[model samples]
Target: MVTDKEGYAQLIQYLTEHLGLFENAGSGVDGSTVMELFEDLLAAQIIVVCGQNPELSFSQRNTIIREVDAIMYDLEEILAGCGRQQVNREQSYFITEFTGLVKNLFDHEIAQLVR
Candidate 1:
C-alpha cells in the first residue's frame, strides 16, 4: 500500500500531466489518445482507492471499478465530441467543465482517501 502522502503526491502529479490535454484542446486529439488518457486516470483512481482501503472486498472493488467506468464513458463521449469539432466557445466550455470535474474528483473524493 502506498503512504497517504505518496498517494496524494501521485494524484497531484497525474493531474498536472493530464491538464495539458485540456489546455491543448482539439490539437490532433485522437480516439486512441483519449482512450489511453481515460485508462491512465482509471488506473490512478483504482490504485488510490485500493491503497487507502486495503480491506475492501473483491466485490466492492469491482463495484467501484464499474462506477468509475460509467463516469469515464460519459466523460469520454463529451471529450470525443469536443475532438470532433473545431475549438469553439461551446466546446471550450465543455473542456473547462471536464477539467473542473476531474479537479473536483481529486479535490473531494481522492483527497478524502489520502486525508
Candidate 2:
C-alpha cells in the first residue's frame, strides 16, 4: 500500500509475466478467492501498518501474518511446475514479500510493541 498503485502494478506485472509460462494461468488466477483476499489485505494494510487499532492484540496480528503466509504458500504450491518454472517461482516470491512489506510498513514505535 505504501508503494501505491505503481508498486502493486509492478508486482502484479512481474507475476503475470512469469505466470505466462503456466499452462493454465488464467484459471489459477481467477478460480481462487485468494486474489480477492489479497485485495482485502491491501485495504486493511493501513490499519496494521499504522497500528491504527489499539484493540488489536499481538496474537491477532500474528494470526494475520500467518494467514497471509498460508495464502502465499498455497499460491506457491499451486505454482510448482517444470524446471524452467523454478525461475518464475523464485521471481514471484514477491507474493510472500507482501508479508514483509506489511511488516515493514509498521511504524517504528508500533513494531516494538508488536511482539
Candidate 3:
C-alpha cells in the first residue's frame, strides 16, 4: 500500500515530467513557473481534502491553510512581475490542463490517496 506521501510524490513526479503539456506558447510562463503553479494548485486542493478528513485536527487544517497561503503569496509575487494578459492566459491553461490531468491520470482523485 502506498502511503499518502508516496502517492503525492508520484503525482508530483508525473506532473513534473509532463510540465510541457501545461505550458502556453507566448504566455511568458516558464517551466519553473508552471511547476510552481501546479504545486500551488495541488496544495490548494489538498486543503479541501483536509477539511473533509475527520482525522485531521482543526489546528492541522489551519497549519496547512497557512502554508498554502504562503505559497499563494509567492506565486502572486511571480505573477505580479508578469504581464496581466499573459498571466491570465497561462493561468487558464494551467487550470484546464491540471484538471484534465487529475481526471485522466488519477481518475479525478486530486489527493491520490484512494490509489
Candidate 4:
C-alpha cells in the first residue's frame, strides 16, 4: 500500500475515536455498523483527495486496498482482544468488496479526478 503504517494507524484511530466501538456500555464495537460507515467515508475521501492524480496505475490502486485491509485487520485484532465477538457481517463484506471496487474505479478515475 502507498500509505505507511503511521498513516494507517492514524486512520483507524480516528475511526475508533470518532465513530466509537460501542453503541452502549458493555456492548462492544458494533463492527458491522461502524465499519460500513468508516469504509464508505474513507473510500470517498480517497477518491476525492487522490483521485486527481492521473498517473496512478492498477498496482497503485491495489496497494490502497491492501493498505486499508492491513489497517482494518489491525483494528479487528485489537477489538477481538478487547473481548468483542468479531462478526463477519456487512462491514466485513463491504471492506472486502469496496477494496476491489475502489481499485476498479481507480482504473477509470486515474486519468482525472471525478466525483
Candidate 5:
C-alpha cells in the first residue's frame, strides 16, 4: 500500500536499523533530539507522497525517489556534522542513482520521503 502510514512506518523502521537513531541513546547531547526531528520531517514528507495516487507513474516515482534521496542526504550530513554519525556523501548519492522505491526497498525505503 502506498498509504502514508505504511511508508512512514517503513522509513521509521529502516532509520531505526540503519541510523541507529532510535536505539542508540548514548550517542550525543543533542543527537537524539535531531533524530526525532528528522523522523518527524521525513514522516511529513511521506504523508504528502502517499496522498498522491498509489499507482504512480515512472516519472512520479522517480521524482519522489529523487526528493527522498536529497532529504536523506541532508539528514545524514546533519548527523555527521554533529559527530553523531559518519556517512560517505559520494556513497550515499550512488545509492540514489540505482534506487527505485519498489524492488530495492530494503536499501531504498528511506527514498519514500517525498514532499
Candidate 6:
C-alpha cells in the first residue's frame, strides 16, 4: 500500500538509485546524494517502525539519527561546493528544490505519525 507520491517508496528508490546526482559515477553514487536520499528513507522507515514496533533495534534508532544528520551535512556541502557565479546560481536553485522535496517528505511522515 505504498503511495506513489513523494512518500517512502520514492524515497527508497532514491536511496537505492541515488537520483538527482551523477548517473554513472562508477561503483555507486557519491555520498552527498546517497546520504540525502538515505535520510528521507530512514525517517520514513523509522516512523513506520515506531508505529508497528516501537522497540526497534538500538542500532536502527541510531542509524536514523545519523542519516538525518548526514542529510544536513550534505546539504551544506552541496551549497558550498557550487563554485563559479553562473554554476552557483543554477546549483543554488537546484539545492532549494532538492531540499524542498526532502522537507516535504519528512513533514508528511511526521503528520502521518501524528495522526
Q: List the RMSD of every prediction in angstroms.
A: 9.7, 10.3, 7.6, 8.3, 11.0, 10.5
Q: Local error of candidate 4 at 104, Å?
A: 22
The clash count for each model shown is 0, 0, 0, 1, 0, 0
Candidate 1 per-residue C-alpha lDDT over 2-109 given as tens digits, one digit per residue, 9 for 90 to 100: 223354455446544554445454644333344455555556656765676776668756756665666566555545633333353433444444444444454454
lDDT of each: 0.50, 0.46, 0.47, 0.48, 0.44, 0.46
Error of 5 at 69 (Å): 1.7
Task: Rank all candidate structures by their TM-score, best first, as comma-separated numbers.
Answer: 1, 4, 3, 6, 5, 2
| lDDT for 44 (candidate 5) | 54
> TM-score of model 6 relative to the true fold?
0.36
> Which residue segments of model 3 deviate by more than 4 Å?
1-47, 83-90, 96-115
Q: lDDT of candidate 3 vs native?
A: 0.47
Better of 1 and 5 by lDDT: 1
In model 2, residue pairs whose N, Cα or C atoms come closer than 3 Å (at least 3 residues apart or on different chains), thus clashing, are none
For model 1, where is the 10-residue window of minimal lDDT?
1-10
Question: Candidate 5 residues 1-115, lDDT tens each?
Answer: 2323465456445543555432333434333344344444455545555554466666766766666666566556545543333223432332233223323342234344432
Clashing pairs in 5: none
Clashing pairs in 3: none
Model 6 per-residue lDDT tens digits across residues 70-101: 65554445433321112223333444455556
| Candidate 4 worst ten-residue window by lDDT | 19-28
Q: Write the per-residue lDDT of candidate 2 for residues 9-112, one digit (tens) a residue.
A: 45445555656445433224323233443445544664555366576677756755564455445445555552122223333344446644644544432445
TM-score for candidate 4, please give it: 0.45
